[model samples]
Target: MKIKTTEQYNRIIQGATAILLTEGLAAFSTTKVAKHIQMAQSNIYVYFKNKDDLLVSVFRYHQKKYIQFLVDRIDLSLPPTDALRNLVSTLDEFHRTNKESLDVIWSIRQSTTLRQLIPKVSDDQIFIAIFQWLKDWQHQGTVRQLPLMYLTNLVFSAIIDYFQLIDSKEMSPNELAIEEIVPPLSALLFV
Candidate 1:
């Protein structure tokens, strides 16, 4: 099939993500993306220089979607505690609806090659905003004095672990209610 429309670019990224999540990076290739989307392999080169470029694009595509979701659903201006609760609820909502996105993120995170190829996310605008928000919380004595990155990583790491447990069948979302989960998460976030 001919990759004539701009929509093909989106298909390429989606196809690549599906491949990475299902078959792992070892099975990822621009040709595979093309084949997955029923386009010619050469057509993929029209948008990406190589597999690395395509992989990075795929990562950024999903990451931007996630960041946008947070920006839209999480009200950063709320009192810090309320903001954190909204953030947790937003994450749970994301986990329920976009589990494949979490899988794609985890797959890229575990890959050394992808990690090196993907640009740093710390400089992303929403990321900086979150970091600054953490700093403000610290200033207000809303959270501990630990380094911002440490606190951020701790929360994100725990979220990832929670998702992984669900993915691995060690935990079931229906078995535990969101109300059952919120208090402990709040305890962790607040001083």
Candidate 2:
């Protein structure tokens, strides 16, 4: 029962993603995905050789989609400060809208086996692009001369912490205002 069409493949991937998000990695199985999609369990084998392969595919699909979303929002032509603001806003919005997907990604990263199985998916290309932009800004004396990795971690870690606060309902909307948040973070990274 090899997937004969793009539609079927997408359907299986969607099913897999939903299962991973809801049930988590420990309970994820091709049979569960098949049941979720209302297909025979054996049918999933046509598209993926095993549960690990299917999970890897699901991770890759979401990773590419998320990166594209971030890339679309960021404009390299903008001033470094403005570009950083846009990037932060985009990231906040992405996390707000894709909480479940982000959770799945985080879980995958935490699991050494799954993390190694899909090494390329774990590569944060959007962060790399941002690092390059920051380096350019540093050369122009617009941003502070910190290590690129340190700056990248500082910015993204703050965003991640904000998401966690929101997830736990510990932060109110007023407290999470981007205006109040992004400026200080921008100042920390920029001159």
Which predicted model would earn the best TM-score? 2
Scored by lDDT, model 1 comes in at 0.78
Q: What is the C-alpha lDDT profile of model 2 across 1-191, one tens digit per residue?
A: 35377898899989988898889888888878888999988777887888888888888887877888888787866877677778878888888787766876777777878888875431588877878888888899988998988888888888888878878889976776764677888879888
> Could you tell me the lDDT of residue 81 within candidate 2?
64
Per-residue lDDT of model 1, residues 1-191, tens digit only: 44466788888888999888878888877777778789888888888889988888888888888778777897878887677677777888988898777677667867887887775657655567778888988899987888888777766666667777777989887886544555676677679
TM-score of 1: 0.88
- List the global CA lDDT of all models: 0.78, 0.80
Top of the candidates by lDDT: 2
Tell me the lDDT of candidate 2.
Answer: 0.80
- Displacement of the residue 24 alpha carbon in candidate 2, Å: 1.2
Could you tell me every candidate's TM-score relative to the true structure? 0.88, 0.89
